[model samples]
Target chain A: MSTPLLEAQGVRFSYDGRTPVLPGTDFALREGDFVGLIGPNGAGKSTLLHVLSGWLRPSAGKVRLAGRPLRDYTARDLALHIAVVLQREEHTFAFNVLDLVLMGRFAHGAGTLGFESEADRGIALEALAQVGLEGFENRRASELSGGEYQRLAIARALAQQSPILLLDEPTASLDLAHQRHLYSLLDRLNREEGRTILVVSHDINAAAAWCRELALLQCGEVVRRGGPRELLRPEVLEEAYGVPVAVGELEGGQPLVAVRR
Target chain B: MSSPTPDRSQARRTALWWALLAVAWLLVLGLAPLAGAAEISLPRALGFGVPEGEFNPDAQILFHSRLPRVLFALVAGGLLALSGAVYQAILRNDLADPYVLGVSGGAGFGALLVLTLAPAAVVAFLLPAAAFAIAAAAVLLIYGMSRWRGPHTPPATFLLAGITLNLLFGAGILLTQYLSDPYQTFRMIRWLMGGVDVGSYRVVAFVAGVGGAASLVIVWRARHLDLLSLGEQTAHHLGVPVASTRRLALFGASLVAAVVVAYAGPIGFVGLIVPHLLRLVVGPDNRVLLVACLLGGGVFLALCDTLARTVLAPTELPVGVVTAFTGAPFFLWLLFRKV
Candidate 1:
């Protein structure tokens, strides 16, 4: 219907000129959509995310964001439009949670290298609050637990205030409760805030329960793409994951998937 | 979560750090010239008023010797520290310094080359220019080597490349020393030890001019340095032009290191120690950290030079020796403390 917020057509990527990871891949995201990218290990899910966010260039074809070629946007302009929550970074520097979060405001600020204005500070604080890390602003990032750090990372992207958010394996280190919290937060941002979100997760049940659509990546290709109901069927998942996964349902008819013995 | 609130406390704390460091720096500036061999009143040395009973020779000593030496220490220390901080940030390692990137080694080689080739009368001009050129070249070589794996020079590769370059330059200097005559060898040895024994104001002016320009460039890019600490990809996502920023930072920092090494003969530890110490006091914000390093580094090196001149009372150990003696202990303690 409307122009897709982002689209990749026949995109191919390789590492060190080896075999292509995303060989002949095609994907699209609509505005305000919650999409989950679920794949088995080494299926190039993270690589695809990097390609979409312009962190990595595809060897063939191109990615278009907001009807513009991804390469057409400078890093600054692209950052202003797309916020990325990377996997848990190492505690290399002694930046506090607030400092890390405020970094998200880098692209949105006015001058060449703008200082954090009062308004920027307010937005950063609000973002921290949104992630329930308000009082933890003064805490060192090194001091944060894995789940708290993930939340802080999310807070940083929230502070970016971009229209689109891309997260890679956000729930990998998170506990059950934090995972639920993160999923709900992503859902709320997608629905209430009208932010388009593409989250990569290995948790199929969680992906089915939360995301409006799921894209199953098998090896390097988007093998199946549809709503949870259509993609969570046993035959499709079995083909993609190469595991006999039992696809069942919750009390509310949400899909539940478990690996068959 | 509580209502959104500005971090007034952090802001106030940073302000307090600035005020305190500024005041302490001014005090060091006043007292630095007084700690040398001859006694000179702080007021008289600062040119506030001539003391009624002050001797002309002591005043002459203050003006001719101590004053220039102190000024040189302040400027050179500030430059070295700023260079160290920049290297540490761009290279993302605590051990990254001018010496690590072979700047000091290349500079040392340049100085020895001047001694071996240029006449004594024209050495003052030739030495610094040659050193600066060679040091910059060495850094460029290091950067080139680090970029072997595509565009992104990973921190580990960068550090290893620097170490390799340092060894290569170090061998060159050693060869130069071996080839020189006894008198030239003596001069090279003294220069390599790194000292702050300024005999004239001209050297002071040269260092201060270059150091001031370099510090300004660094402060202007301090915000980028802050973003860079997040690592390249994250910083890129945050809109920093990582490649250009890396290039500019390397050029600016290497220029400061080369010029200071040219003038001061590769004074040790001020660059490495000042930033490490100040980061603990002022958090990791580069805006504050860089400025604080400028002042704190100046004071630290000035104080160390004072001790170098006075501790042995006319024996005059090289300022580098004093710095290593002091810095080595702190560095070891820091390592053991695991901070």
Candidate 2:
């Protein structure tokens, strides 16, 4: 078997160096895999994402990207590989969507003189088009609706054109239609572009429908890792979410899951 | 993905605006020397043609007094505004100013100490140098105190530490004034009120060189400043050396602001208002914003000084008072406006 694109062996991270948020968890992602990491609130899903993205350092063990230690990569070198869309951001001044999206090209050497090259601008425009924000180039970022802003964030990540994309609750504020739109976009990137995607979400049904693989985490550890059909079983989800859930089938024969309550 | 064609008009528009401002600045510089108590003919004062005979006092006043003063205002104001632009970006606070970081307070205290303690012949250059050293030290101290949160100190914490230091330095200056004799106390008061009476060409050259160098450093790092506006975490993720960039920006901004305060005392509100007003005109692109502020600040303080010294004829108001008088109303208007 080919080596995984990313691997975390016994990775442990703690904010205060005492009770670890990610207590020696082992995880791996093969190239071009669409993986969903889902769990209840405070399950260290975001912490794990941070550790994987180099935002936070693990207290023990190590994470490797492309078979090399993640810590060995410089920030720019790492940025050339992974693009991240954080859960929240607060900007003091308003930037137009074009300007904000163009920032994604920074690591790619787009804004060295604060002027966007033609190629950089082209890439930004294409990324905005991918996010269905082609006409939003002039709109102020701070003035966007919740869903639009989320899409803009995704567009920025897309502009990075990195091989790996990591998202933390990207659809938290998105409506159902917008959420479906975002997943479709991610699906295209994974299948057509052959990019690796890792998403942290609480939406188990959506995760099962979209992600090729699911890792169910509970209390800083993955309780189960398998295909969505295997991990979305009622017994497995109940153990992770601490709630009764039912697994069923749609008329189209696709697996369906919902909370029992 | 298909390649796109970027619109070139925005760049053209920005260049046009800068060119207009440059022309306006030249006009201001030309007329500035003609406005003071002793009126010199605009053409003759500018040394257009040689005078017929005798000692020309108007030429002396133009060369010795008005010219250096005008140049001083331009350089000093430009430095303050440039510093303000950097501070606002690094702190991620629109209200952040050069004085908000305690640079002026520390430099003011340092200059006051020299003025009160040093003998009559302390030389013009040593005072500003002392002030710059102390201001730079104050910045390092604030950064140290605020670094309880690992290598990166968040902007809010840094701002709080700066305010606390500003108050402490203000108290130190007050105590010094209490200990000084009457004549020294009077001199300290005038200096604290801030003066741009840059009588010597040598002082103008020094301010211009130092201020120009600091502005150049900021302009060179304009890209980093743009990233910094997105907050440190986002900037870091975009490959900015967040801690190092923040340190360099803070030092450069503080050094520039201190240079102005060291010589001119602490001119108020030019740093605070110039960038704020320019943002409304040019938007938040720091590359263009910093350049605009650099030129606009020079124009602003030069004009304000002209009005301050000319409006009262023989009695000149403190330049700080002129800035505050004009800036406070505009600030109030901005607060109520949609911007």
Task: Compose the digit string of candidate 2's lDDT tens values, residues B157-200.
Answer: 88888888889989999999999998888988888888788788
User: Residue pairs in steric clash, candidate 1?
Assistant: none
lDDT per residue as tens, model 1, B1-339: 343335565567767887887787778767777786666675665556766666566577777888788878887888788889998998888888767787888888888899999999999789888888888888888777667657776887877877777788789888998988999999899999998876789988977787788778878888788888778888878788788888888888888888888878888888998898888888778877888888888888888998988998767889999999999899888768964
Candidate 1's C-alpha runs over 4 A off are A110-115, B1-11, B40-56
Docking quality (DockQ) for each candidate:
0.47, 0.49
TM-score of 2: 0.95
Candidate 2 clashes between residue pairs 3 or more apart in a chain or in different chains = none
Q: Any runs in candidate 2 off by more than 4 Å, and if so which? A: B1-5, B46-53, B123-125
What's the count of clashing pairs in each model shown? 0, 0
Write model 1 residue lDDT over A218-239, tens digit each, in one string. Answer: 8788888889988899988788
CA lDDT of every candidate: 0.84, 0.85
TM for every model, in the order presented, reads 0.93, 0.95
lDDT of 2 by residue, A1-261 (tens): 889898888999888778888989999989999999998888899999988988788989889999999989877778889999988876777788898998898888776674788788888888988878888888889889988888998998998899999999999999998889889999999999999999999887788788999998888998888888777788877777778988997765557888876
TM-score of chain B of each: 0.91, 0.94
